[model samples]
Target chain A: MNANIPSEVLPILLILIGTIFSLLSAIGLVRLPDVYTRSHAASKSTTLGVLFILVGTFLFFLLEEHYFSIRLFLGIFFVFLTAPVAAHVLVRSAYRSNVALAEESVQDDLKDFIHTDSKKTKDAEVNDTD
Target chain B: MIEIMLICSLIFLTLSIIAIMYRLVKGPSASDRVQALDTLGINIISGVAVFSVLMRSTGFFEVILLIGILSFIGTIAFARYLERGVVIERKHPK
Candidate 1:
């Protein structure tokens, strides 16, 4: 199946795939109900989208220009490394700062842990006051 | 044929960027805005990549790297500030 298509078509195919995913991510950002869901969209889809686009771009440069671009490789690695961390931080801070979850959310396992932690802190504060 | 595909992808990227910008502007909470901003940064990187292909130049690769680093820092800082009301802390002598 792979033999029939010309070599030049692959990069273009990758780019189109990346573009569609990226657009879906953006649409998700706008359409999702709250910060948590939107963050999910922003992080996962964009990471994959950018990865595809970067790989495609890398191949295009490699094949057409016969140039090996270290920067393209670096960009791909950087995006993969940083995007998830950024999303995690964003969601953590949002949760800590009392950002309301969507009404439709069914369960919150973190609530118990957070409540216990806060209770322990209050106990420590009372001991300090004595 | 490739040029035409590239052009269409570029248009799609632009539309995606616009959608992200809308969320950035109208997000009901700070975290949503920050999330939008982070996504926007990623979109910009893709846009730059597409443009580099369109122009057949390697010059913009550095710009993509720079944006990636800066946006990461920006997101972290904003997250820290949101979490603790401070982005940096100094230890006080006991």
Candidate 2:
């Protein structure tokens, strides 16, 4: 109710910073050259952004409304668990499917490993359909 | 004054979503579109959080979790489909 309280100010500050983070992630997504780099921006920055934003809301409700929302806390936990995993899964698929990396990218350590890996799996898939 | 700040944040979040949408539509590869969808889900979650805070209510909490779960599952499924052209993994073909 009272914005003058120092604790109250913290939540709003967090919300604003998170908004900036999300905005930056959006910019990164639009500007990045490859899906991998874009995933980096999307997963890392947006995870931080959403986490901070949710934490701000949780604190706001706890302090101002005298409420403790277990759901909000759980939401925080779920995002922490899932964002990176999803990004990794997507990039893995992209690489295996031969989606080319951005030309300027510096290294290709997974090149040989993925070649052997996908071949075995591709053979198994051929059998599965038969 | 607080309401104004929340509104401004909402505006910024909307802009973020729109920028992402361009990538979703024009992305050269399916993987790019999948990544865009994941980011879009995150933005929606943040937007709902801001709107909930502005409303001064706790009701949007469930929506946040639901979207998170669905986005995660959808991303995983798409990734699997892209990798091996299979999502459910019916058999290993021993």
- Which number leads on lDDT? 2
In model 1 chain A, where is the ten-residue run with the lowest total lDDT? A1-10
lDDT of model 1 at position A71: 89
Q: Give the candidate number with the greatest TM-score.
A: 2
Worst 10 residues of 2 chain B by lDDT: B85-94
Off by over 4 Å in 1: A1-5, A116-130
Fraction of native Cα contacts reproduced by each candidate: 0.90, 0.90
- Pairs in clash, predicted candidate 1: none
- Pick by DockQ: which candidate is best? 1
Residue-wise lDDT of candidate 1 within A8-116, one digit each (tens)? 5787789899999999999998999999888878999999999889998998888777899998899999999999999999999998888998999999999888768
Which ten contiguous residues of candidate 2 chain A have the minimum total lDDT? A1-10
lDDT of 2 by residue, A1-130 (tens): 6655776777888899999999999999999999878888988999999998999999888887789999999999999999999999999899989998899999999999989977888797789787
Q: What is the C-alpha lDDT of each candidate?
A: 0.91, 0.92
The DockQ of each candidate is 0.91, 0.90
Q: Is the docking of candidate 2 incorrect, acceptable, medium or high quality?
A: high
TM-score of each: 0.92, 0.93
lDDT of 1 by residue, B1-94 (tens): 6788999999999999999999989999998898999999999999999899888999999999999999999999999999878898755424
